[model samples]
Target: MTNTPTHNRERSCIACGAKASKADLLRIVRTAEGISFDASGKLAGRGAYVCSPECFDKARTGRLSHALKTKVSNEEAQVVAQALQAHIQRA
Candidate 1:
C-alpha cells in the first residue's frame, strides 16, 4: 500500500474567527432537539466551533446561533457551556 500523509481538517471558531485543526476546537451541534455540547464531534446536525470558554462566551451571545442558523437562548447556551466546562475539567 502507498503511504499517505494524514490531513488535519481545519475549522474556524465562531466566536473569535480563529482557525485551527478541528480536534483543537470544541464543537457544538444544533439539531431539532436543541443545541448541545458535542464532545465526540460526531453529532449529526449543524455544528459550530469555539476555541475556548472565553470565545464560547462571545459566541453564545449571538455568533453561535447565527453560525448554527438557529435561535439559541441564553439559558440554553449556559447549559451547553456548563457541559463543555465539565468535559474540560475531566480531561
Candidate 2:
C-alpha cells in the first residue's frame, strides 16, 4: 500500500502577521473589478488574509494595500468591511 501525506495550506494575516490555515482566516481579494471579501477562498485575484475583525481593521489602514499591490480606497475598504461584518454575523 502507498501512503500519501495530506497538505494543509497556510497563510499569514496581513494585519497581525499570524500564520494560520487558509480556511481559518478570512480572505480579501483584489481583482480588476475591485476589492472585496472572498468568503469562498477561491477568488481569482490578489488575496490577503486577516485572522480576526480587529486585524481586518488594522489591515484597512495600510497593510492590505501593501499586500494587494494596489491602492485601497476608503469606500472600497468600507464595502469589504460591511461584507465581513455581515458574514461574521451570519456565522
Candidate 3:
C-alpha cells in the first residue's frame, strides 16, 4: 500500500547532492557568464537543481562559484532568491 504523492518524487540537488522533489526544489541555469535562476524551467543552458533556499545560499557561498565560472554577487543572489520565493509562492 502506497500513499505518497507523485509530486514528492525524489530529485537530486546539483550542489549538495540532496534528493528532493520537483515541487520542493529550484533550478538554476549555467549561462555563458555564470549560473542564474531559470524561473521558466525552460532556459537554454546547463542547469543545476537545488532543494531549498539554504542550498542556494551555500552554492552562492563560493562552493559553486568556480563551476558557475563567475562570482555570485549578493545582488544577483538576491534575484535568484526572489525568483525562487515567487515560484514557491505561486505553487
Q: How high is the CA lDDT of each candidate model?
A: 0.90, 0.91, 0.73
RMSD list, candidates in order: 3.8, 3.7, 4.1
Candidate 3 structure lDDT? 0.73
Please give, for residues 2-86, the per-residue lDDT of candidate 2 as tens digits: 4433576878999888988899999999989999999999999999999887788998979999999999999999999998999
Q: State every prediction's TM-score relative to the real structure.
A: 0.89, 0.90, 0.66
lDDT of 3 by residue, 6-84 (tens): 7666768856888766656687777886567877767887666787777787777675565566677787778887877
Error of 2 at 74 (Å): 0.2
Ranking by TM-score: 2, 1, 3
The weakest ten consecutive residues by lDDT in model 2 span 1-10
Our tally of clashes for model 3 stands at 0
Q: Which sequence of candidate numbers ranks them by lDDT, best first?
A: 2, 1, 3
Looking at candidate 1, the ten consecutive residues that score lowest on lDDT are 2-11
Spell out the clash pairs found in candidate 1: none
Q: Which stretches of candidate 2 lie over 4 Å from their true place?
A: 1-6
Question: Using alpha carbons, what is the TM-score of model 3?
Answer: 0.66
Q: Point out where model 3 deviates above 4 Å.
A: 1-11, 20-24, 32-35
